[model samples]
Target: MPSALLPIIAWDYQFAPNAQKSRNYLYITHTPFKICEQPFLLPRPALLSLGITYRRVPVLSIGKDVFCDNASFLDAMQELLEREGEGRALKRGGADRAFEAWGYRSFWVALASVPAGLVSKELGEDRRELFRRF
Candidate 1:
C-alpha cells in the first residue's frame, strides 16, 4: 500500500515573484499545494508561530517540517517528488544555475526599481529592519 501524502503549504508575500516561482514549479511538477500570503510588515505572526525566525518570503511547510530559503525549499520539493516516483523536476547543470542567478538578480533589480512614493513609510521601515543585517 502507498503512504498518504501530507498537505504542502507555501508561505509568502503577495506579488512576490519568488513565491510565484515556487507555485509555478509545483504546478509544472503536477504537485498539489496551497499558498498563504503574508502581510507586508514586520511581525509575521504565522511565521513566528511556526517557529520560523527567518525574515523572508517563500517558506515551505510540508507536514510538520518547515523549509526556509529557496535552495532548501527546492531541494525538499525535489526529494518529495522523487520519493513519490515523480522524478526530478529541476535540471542540475550550468544552465540551471545561470537561470537561478538571473532570476535572483532580476528580482532584486525589480524591487529596487519600485518608486519610493509607491511604498509606504511603514513598509520601508519594516523592510529596512528586516534586512538590516544584510
Candidate 2:
C-alpha cells in the first residue's frame, strides 16, 4: 500500500536532458507516484482534467490538488516530507554526465526524428541525421 500521487510526464520524441531530469528526479527520490505521461503538443484529457493552463512535463496531482510545473516538484517533495519530519536524498548526487551543444541549434530537435529509438523514432531519420552530432 504505497501513497499515491499523479505524475504527469511529457513523453515526447525529442530528447531533452532537462526533460529527462524531470522524470529522473522522481525516480531518484524513490517516491511512489502514478505516472500520467503526455505526448507531443499536449494531451487533451490531462489538460482538461487538471485544468492545465500551460501544459508541460511532470504535472503532479495529489487527490484534488493539481500542480503543474517541473521547477517546483522538488520543493513539493520537501514540503510533503516536512509533515512527517522525513526527507529523501538523491543517491547519485555526484554522478558525472555531460552534454555539449555546438553551433546554434543543439541538434536535439534534429536527431529526435530518427525511427526505432524513442526520441529518434518520434522526430524521423532525415531529421535525426541532421541533428546527430548534438
Worst 10 residues of 1 by lDDT: 125-134
- Model 1, span 2-24: residue lDDT tens: 11367888898857777888888
Off by over 4 Å in 2: 1-19, 86-134
In the range 113-134, model 2's lDDT, one tens digit per residue, is: 6465454544443344344532
TM-score for all models, in order of appearance: 0.80, 0.48
Cα misplacement distance, residue 3 of candidate 1 (Å): 9.7
Colliding residue pairs in candidate 2: 112-123, 113-123, 113-124, 114-120, 114-121, 114-124
Compare the candidates by TM-score and give the number of the best one: 1
**Top candidate, metric lDDT:** 1
- Give, for candidate 2, the lowest lDDT window spanning 10 residues: 95-104
Q: Rate the local accuracy (lDDT) of all candidates.
A: 0.74, 0.49
